[model samples]
Target: MATTKLTLSVDPEVIAKARRISKLRKTSVSAMFSRYIATLEESKQRETPLPPMTKRALALAAGTAPVPENWDYRDELKDILDERYGLK
Candidate 1:
């Protein structure tokens, strides 16, 4: 594949974190940024609400044993999946 180099300024802390993650994953910073940018662009195309989930409802769903007032089931479900898969 053809490639090109481009330079841009970014926050130092963000670059440091990206570099750390890139090294941990054995990939180049450019590649990591490319993937991240691609995902962000893709998300921009989505039109749905992406499943509603309030923070208080999420806590109850995780078996936190304290269902906050006006809890919603959607949050509970998202919390369950996030916990099981470490998606967070």
Candidate 2:
């Protein structure tokens, strides 16, 4: 892969933590950041479902919820019309 050089800024505390971890693992801080970014990207690419919400949290959001039994989001837009101007 072609690599590009870039600069980034991070908190001093975070840099200190990364430096400690690198020292323990005998790796460079750049490698640690690269691995961290790669792991995050891999997780994003896998399309993993988000963690489940607590029942209390669910109940709180349900106050304004739109979903009812046997609701279909795809068909909800079929009868709606939108007009756009000055494009294309």
Candidate 3:
């Protein structure tokens, strides 16, 4: 396929990172950005929509548990409900 040179105004830090990644992957920065653009286009053309807000909400709620491994989740949930309802 015929390719064109597209000029972009990007931060020097971003250019450094891209150069580093290109070196690690054994490819040119242009090729790396080309693959990225192709992947982005493929995702944009997909039939399925992205996950909704509810899924994001559930993920945020389910982040690594803050409780101890031996803790009883049900007991804590019950206690929370009781406290919420003013039930001693």
Candidate 4:
């Protein structure tokens, strides 16, 4: 892949720390920043295609599992809140 050089302005203290870390790792600061950027890009690429709530709704619509006959979502939510707030 083609690479380009870029200039960055940073605090002297931060630059000094980065230089120390780079020396300890036996690599240049540029390589460290490159790896950091690659990691961020990889995380973005690996994101879920759908949000959890939407996925659950889709599964329910598709009848993946039967809803419980006595299920009360409001009561379930209140129970969850009570548990979370130590009210129960």
TM-score of every candidate relative to the true structure = 0.48, 0.50, 0.54, 0.55
Q: Model 1: clashing residue pairs?
A: none
lDDT of 4 by residue, 1-88 (tens): 7778998999999999999999999999999999999999999999979989999989879965777999999999999999999999
Clash pairs, candidate 2, are: none
Query: Candidate 4: TM-score?
Result: 0.55
Error of 2 at 17 (Å): 1.0
lDDT of 1 by residue, 1-88 (tens): 6889999999999899988999999999999888989999999888465345665666558875776799999999999999999997
lDDT of each: 0.86, 0.78, 0.91, 0.94
Of the candidates shown, which would achieve the greatest TM-score relative to the real structure? Answer: 4
As a TM-score, model 3 comes out at 0.54
Q: Between candidates 3 and 4, which one is better according to lDDT? A: 4
RMSD for all candidates, in order, please.
14.5, 17.2, 8.6, 10.4
State which candidate has the highest lDDT.
Answer: 4
Residue 54 C-alpha lDDT in model 4: 97
RMSD of 3: 8.6
**Stretches of candidate 2 exceeding 4 Å from the true structure:** 1-3, 48-88
Query: Which whole-number lDDT from 0 to 100 does residue 15 have in model 2?
Result: 85
* Model 4: lDDT to the true structure: 0.94
Q: Give the clashing residue pairs of candidate 4, or none.
A: none
Candidate 4: count the clashes.
Answer: 0
